[model samples]
Target: MSLVVSPSKVFRVAEVILEGGIAFAPTDTIYGLLANALDRRAVERLFAIRRPSGRPFLLLIPQEDWIEELGLIIGPRQRKLLSLGITLVIPKRTSVPLYLTRGRKSLAVRLPSSTAGFIRDLLKVVGVPLVAPSANPEGLKPATSVKEGMAYFGRRVNIYVDAGKIVGKPSTIVRLIGYRSVRLVREGNVPFREVLRFLSS
Candidate 1:
């Protein structure tokens, strides 16, 4: 069992992930089971951990520069939402693997203002988007700490980065209905009025 002090400390974490190992780590929202979004087997392992695949995850991207690479386009409104740290469900790029979006027409992507330094650096090191679902198994609450994550995953994960207790809920999820319309799929850490205000600004 590798208990990492921070995501950056562990050279082995990225190595293991490059080799298709899943990790339990804290995110901007909660502890998440992380795997390379481009790795089919690793993603399948994440689905297996969820036992029937209940909660789909948003992809953690390091920056906006990756927009074209993923086959996604962001307009002014999306740029605003990104500034507010809201997750946007946008049209998938044709190059995106089906496993990443579960064959859905859209997928969630966010820069995650809540990540630790380690998570940020790890994203840079991995050089690929990562799928981070809440660390608990299906039907369980999202784990906010390492202890809770461990209870759910035990030794099933390759690395565990304990960031103590993380605050706040998940990011607000918005689905773009068209060029002019947006839908609130989930009201989470960010408030609805704030989202409206941001979009309007």
Candidate 2:
């Protein structure tokens, strides 16, 4: 444990993240480590906490248009993917920090489609995009509840938001290699058939 916290104040937790602190909270998919994606210092701390150096984290934005804030473009299908709760690996902007993409020129991101109201509201307040990697040491199972995450991180994280139990599988990851050329990097919760249908549309 690092600092005393009030888990019930979601906005306060959001504020912590805004100030370069890492928080543990249930996301649209699972419990994850939340930090300001654009803050290199904060992001570096997140990498240290998550174990293994240089693992790419998915950025969680509030809206599809926000991707442009990082100097990337968004297409209709890409927007559609968000509606489907997909983690999109899109081409990265040159302006984005090397830390975020591990010196690569592409980034993985999503606009969280959380069913939980509090999570959504918190995301709304944060405004800035956040890196939401599953809350646990590297090579361990992703946490589905605050209790599960506490077991993994103890008090290393600044805040914890419990949305009961988040049992959904991880989001499917798709890489936009080329225009209209989408590739599956990983399959978890999203059905492949639907992806096919989306590609065909």
Candidate 3:
């Protein structure tokens, strides 16, 4: 019972999201369930699907440049490096809820490179940052298609946006240790060498 979708139908999907429904949608790396990051109900639904807790979900922004406005506690050095397409997980002091931050002072934030414009515009309409992790349970293979996302989430998610398969693996993850130091959390599409070059310079 998979539904095939097109780019023209993004607005339809957005409407569903506005009504407080979760969606399985395509990304540059894989299919991810998108919901209003600020909504506790939506986040609860996401956690129910993945049975995940203790670990915080990553927030994906549409534009790398928008990180400044969205993040209240990013350092100047971290902001500068992030503008170059580096994924930065930095500490934040905000009322964004401890559930989203996993009771930690830090938050994992990134601007997806490939779907920057489309995702950014979608978020603008939704009026919330998107909390998107892999569309699968923790420690499992990330879904690369709508079918995979459905398989993992089943009827937990309200809708599906099928846009074919993803091009590659997951996005790279790096945590800002100090002003200029970043630790590799997970190596995926972005190589470690490239990340090093960005932080070094």
Ranking by TM-score: 2, 1, 3
Counted clashes in each candidate structure: 0, 2, 0
**What does the lDDT read for residue 39 in candidate 3?**
79
* Alpha-carbon local distance difference test for all models: 0.76, 0.79, 0.71
Cα lDDT tens digits, model 3, 1-201, are 434466557787778777777878875466777887777888878887775655878787665555555544665666655554445788776755777887787888866664454565666667667888777787888788777877787777877876777756677778887666778888887887887876667
List model 2 lDDT by residue over 1-201, tens digit each: 544344468778877888888898767777789999878999988898895768689988887777778876556655577767788888866887788888777888877766645557777898888898888788888887778888888767887776677777888998886656678989977887787697778
For model 3, what is the alpha-carbon lDDT of residue 172?
79
Candidate 2: regions farther than 4 A off: 1-8, 114-116
TM-score of each: 0.88, 0.89, 0.85
Q: Residue by residue across 21-129, what tens digits does model 1's lDDT show?
A: 8888767666788898888888888888765653456888877776667887667666667766778888776777777767777788877673446677778788888
- For model 1 the local lDDT of residue 65 reads 73
Error of 1 at 26 (Å): 1.2
Q: Which candidate, 1 or 2, would have the higher TM-score against the true structure?
A: 2
**Which 10 consecutive residues of model 2 have the lowest summed lDDT?**
1-10
